[model samples]
Target: MVVAVVAAGGPGPLINGFGVDTSCLGYDAHNVAQGDADNTSHNILHTHSNKSRQSSPGKNFPLQNNSIALEIMVNVPKERKTYCAGKCKKHAVHKVTQYKAGKASNFAQGKRRYDSKQMGFGGQTKPVFHKKAKTTRKIVLRLECKKCKTKKQLCLKRTKHFELGQKAAASGHQY
Candidate 1:
């Protein structure tokens, strides 16, 4: 989800909303001098929101206060059409799978240090995170080229319910 801080006047520059800056593109000294900055600023923001919505089409990120909530699609298909780095000349069909993290090795420096600290009979050596804010994790798609067998990963937006390969019974359904 995108984190946006709203000021008393209007939505300030986005702290981090898909790494996009929410600052009004039409802002300039001329507009402010003519006293038309406020009027044009909101229009520019609406234009930016339209472009963002069109770029993804699936995810509707909020840019202005009017567009506060929008449904997010979390279902992914088994196959995807993405650029292949290996043998394909251009965009080609690829096999899509959910990316999974491998198990961490016990011999890692952090693991070893944690083990030693626990053996010394300390109740809690490290600070445990309690105030969890985010409720969803970003979904990663592992794409493999059909011809060259090349693999690439793509990170997607965070969603409460994520599905891979099969369609979910209810996801962003307008009903």
Candidate 2:
């Protein structure tokens, strides 16, 4: 006996062994002959037959958009600890500036010798010295508000600089 399979939706394409055309009686014969086969087979392939929904459109365009230009200023943090006691603030600052030089070696070596002497077992022990590294660029900026007689200092780090740029872009401003 010839069996027919019909889909619930209007006539379109034949999916698997079933067709959607209601004009054909093949679906009715298949349902009567195969019974549960019609239901199980159609459910397995239902997902492939469904159409996808389109995404919603975005909002209206922005107006008065202006490019945001930033001048990043990097500075040392306040309340930082000093390497040695009784050293003048200027000396501390100078040491940080001369970080690239090997001047700090003497101070580091002196501290190590003092520590080893306190331990009382030192004989040609390795000298603990600060390794000379590259110097970082410092930022300086002075910001004044025109509306009020208020002035403020601003410092930007690497992460803060990128965050500022992202904020500008999110606000519909060109960065």
Candidate 3:
């Protein structure tokens, strides 16, 4: 049978046809090679071949299970070339911007109804909603055609941080 060992920065090892992570066994490459190779769920049995092999407590092991704090941000370009269904009706350069809601109008049907109902009210007519559960709002990209000045919006997934064509320089050494 074929036995393929996987380490960090490499794809997971395939025991049979499925890939599996063996780093959770608290064994590094040095101990892994000296121990008996067991492809079944990383239950390794340590058997030193020679007396010269000694475990070093000072050696650092690779981080297991990918427990790293990652910075995730959604960044979109300031300008994009896309289809403009306006006067041009063709692919053109579109100015990219973040979509934001405008001020709510008090003259709206709901607001008008609420305001009229609130007149000489005994108490609050409806229960105020306070159970907020979401942490982030879905981002929307406003695309305006440079030629036709046509505006469109593209919806994106939820993100904590959003940037437009701004790339921060690496502050430290990047691997």
Give me the candidate number with maximum lDDT.
Answer: 3
lDDT of 2 by residue, 1-175 (tens): 2323444434634544545464433244334324566464553322343446554432232321211222333334332223222323221321222112234554687777766676756575566668965344333333333333233444432222322112232356555
lDDT (Cα atoms) of all candidates against the true structure: 0.63, 0.38, 0.69
Cα error, candidate 1, residue 126 (Å): 1.4
Any runs in candidate 1 off by more than 4 Å, and if so which? 1-70, 168-175
| Residues 1-175, model 1: lDDT tens digits | 3232222233344333333332444333233323364654443322233244344533454453322222365678888887898878689999999889999999999999988988866499888889988766777899999988999899876666677777656568585
**lDDT by residue for model 3 over 58-98, one digit each (tens)?**
34444321222123677789999999998997999999999
Model 1 residue 148 CA deviation in Å: 0.9
Clash pairs (backbone) in predicted model 3? none
Could you arrange the candidates by TM-score from highest to lowest? 3, 1, 2
Per-candidate count of clashing residue pairs (backbone under 3 Å): 0, 6, 0
Model number with the top TM-score: 3
The local distance difference test score of model 2 is 0.38
Full ranking by lDDT? 3, 1, 2
Model 2 alpha-carbon miss at residue 35, Å: 43
lDDT of 1 at 139: 79
Native-referenced Cα lDDT, model 1? 0.63
